[model samples]
Target: MKSSMHNPHLAPEKYGIMDGISECIVTTISSKGPNAAPMGIIKNSNGIKIRVFKGSKTYGNIMNFPFLAANVVYDPKIYTMTTFSNLERSQFDTIVYEDVEFPVLKDGISWMLFECNNLQKSSQSLVADLIPVKAKLSHIDAVRAPNRGFNSVLEACIHATRYQLTGSQKYLDLMQYHAEIIRKCGGKTEKEALDQLYRFMKTNK
Candidate 1:
């Protein structure tokens, strides 16, 4: 079953009201095509906020096209793929809202489409204020996954990307620490994700 809202000014509780940094895979369409990247979104009384760093494709896309989709997903591969490399078109299911195009992961549980209403720029990144104009719920699991090692894996991916961009050994050290946690506490899927990240870092270095 599919569920959607035309203009959900504020995020609905059913979408799991995000308090602080909620990790999501954001998709935006540019002149080139669909682009996906992992972002941390914060739900506030005004709307949602995301930090788009300078010199990244996602930052440029958001500047050119204000409309983007934030997908709530749990798959670790999706997180790693979008962060380290580009995902193929076949990896996403296209959806249109208000005549704007956006891609949603086939396995995404929910999505929120927003238009940038405000932008605060700093030296390194731009903080965008977004208004939720469209939302959809395709699948809702009865039980939420335990965060035994999932959060660590996600954090590790972020650090991995930082390591790639800045060539900082500190980020690599942190990534390695998180990988150890995933090895000891994570399930099969988490282990797979950790392995994928490790391989990417090794080859790229």
Candidate 2:
């Protein structure tokens, strides 16, 4: 069976419903060491728009330094570890890729530059401002595999934020994932925020 996205590189014979949306683990560095977060990139009339949350580290970094790499690689661990506090990996080391900056533990790929001109927020699908920038994809690792267990939970944080931000219709699309994490991992303000997100998503919806 030939995939609609015909690339000999992709493992499975049939690539299902991921027709256009490309998911990338966005790596950014601020005064705070590293932020390896998962983000969705969509093609627009002008170029690519990186959809991220306003309160996320990625958002903060971009605000400080507008330059960032939309790292397109093959690691679900990046997403899982980005949001989860339980991954036992080596500490991040500062590595430079661009003349500007580089992230730790990168998989090397070439010719994968997708210009990000649009910066969409997790709050509104179409309201975020689109910033123009030129970036180079220096490396590419293996093709990305499916996320599961804790990885799946971390992936849901993106969803959780959307539910957290909206003035209306928040819960129906976002509350379910955050609730799961809170029930499983109880703690301080995180638990409060998750519960608050749930309440907000509910009443606002």
Error of 1 at 62 (Å): 0.7
Provide the global lDDT of candidate 1 against the true structure. 0.79
lDDT of 1 by residue, 14-116 (tens): 6653877788888887889888899888876766688889988889988887776788887787888788877898878887765555777777888877777
Instruction: List TM-scores for all candidates, in order.
Output: 0.89, 0.47
Q: Best candidate per TM-score, number?
A: 1
Clashing pairs in 2: 108-139, 108-140, 109-139, 109-140
lDDT of 2 by residue, 1-205 (tens): 0112222343211211123455655566688566666666554444345556566677787665554445554443444345433222353334443354545434523212222333444553322332323333443234544433334344455565454556345544444654565456644444554544445445544
lDDT of 2: 0.45
Estimate the TM-score for candidate 2: 0.47
Runs in model 2 deviating more than 4 A are 1-19, 85-98, 108-205
Quote the lDDT for 94 in model 2.
44
